[model samples]
Target: MIKRVHVLEDDEDIRYIIGVLLKDEGYELQLSSSFSDLKSKLKDSVPDLFILDVMIPDGNGTDICADLKNDIFTKQIPIIVMSADDKNKDKSLGAGADDYISKPFDIDHIVNRINKLLVK
Candidate 1:
C-alpha cells in the first residue's frame, strides 16, 4: 500500500524539497505551512506518518506530536520530529515522537529513517 506522510513545516523551500524526496520514494504527501490550520489539514486525510518541525508559526511541533500520540485515533501513526535545535531532541522523544532528525538533514538519512519507521 502507498504510505501517506503529513509534513508540518513552515519553511517553504525545505518543505517542498522534502515533499519531492518522499514523493520520489512513492509516498503520498500532505504539506501544511499554516500552523493555525493544521487540524483542518490533518482532518482531510489520515496519514501513515508525520514529519513535524519543532519551530512553526503560532504553534509548537513537539506539542502537536504529543497530542497526536495521545489521541486514540492517531496514536498508531509514526511521527518524526525534525528540528535545527538539537536541544529538543530528548524533549521530542519525551513528547512521544518516534524519531528525531536534526535540521541540515541529509536526504539519504531522511529517506532511511522514514523507511525504517514505515516498516513498523
Candidate 2:
C-alpha cells in the first residue's frame, strides 16, 4: 500500500517542496497550511505520518503534536517536526514528535528519517 503523509506547514515554498519530494518517493501527500485545514484533513482520514512545522500562522505545531499524541485515535500516528529553532527539537520531541528536523534541513536526511519511521 502507498503510505500517506500529511504536511502541516504555513510556508508555501517549503510545503510545495516537501510535497514534490515525497510524491516522487511514491507516497501520497496531504498538505495543510493552517490548523483548521489540518483538522479538516484529519477528519477525512489520518495519514501514515505527519510532517509538522513548529511555527504556523494559526498555531504552534508542538501544541498540535501534543494534542495528537494525547488523543486515543491519533496517538499511534508518527510525527516529524520541522523548526527553524534548533532548541525546539527537544521541546518537540518531548511533545511526542517521532523525529525533529531543523530548517535548512537536508532533503535526503528528511527522506531517510521518514523512511525509518515508516519502517517502524
lDDT, each prediction: 0.92, 0.95
Segments in model 1 whose C-alpha atoms lie over 4 Å from true places = none
Candidate with maximal lDDT: 2
lDDT for model 1 comes to 0.92
Model 1 Cα displacement at 23 (Å)?
Answer: 0.8
Look at candidate 2 and tell me the lDDT of residue 83. Answer: 97
Q: List model 1 lDDT by residue over 6-28, tens digit each.
A: 99999999999999999999999
Angstrom error of the Cα, residue 112, model 2: value is: 0.3
Error of 2 at 15 (Å): 0.5
Which stretches of candidate 2 lie above 4 Å from their native place? none
Clashing pairs in 2: none
What TM-score, over all chains together, does every model reach? 0.96, 0.98
Model 2 over residues 1-120: C-alpha lDDT tens digits?
999999999999999999999999989999999989999988999999999999999999999999999999889999999999998999999999999999998999999999999983
Residue 98 C-alpha lDDT in model 1: 98
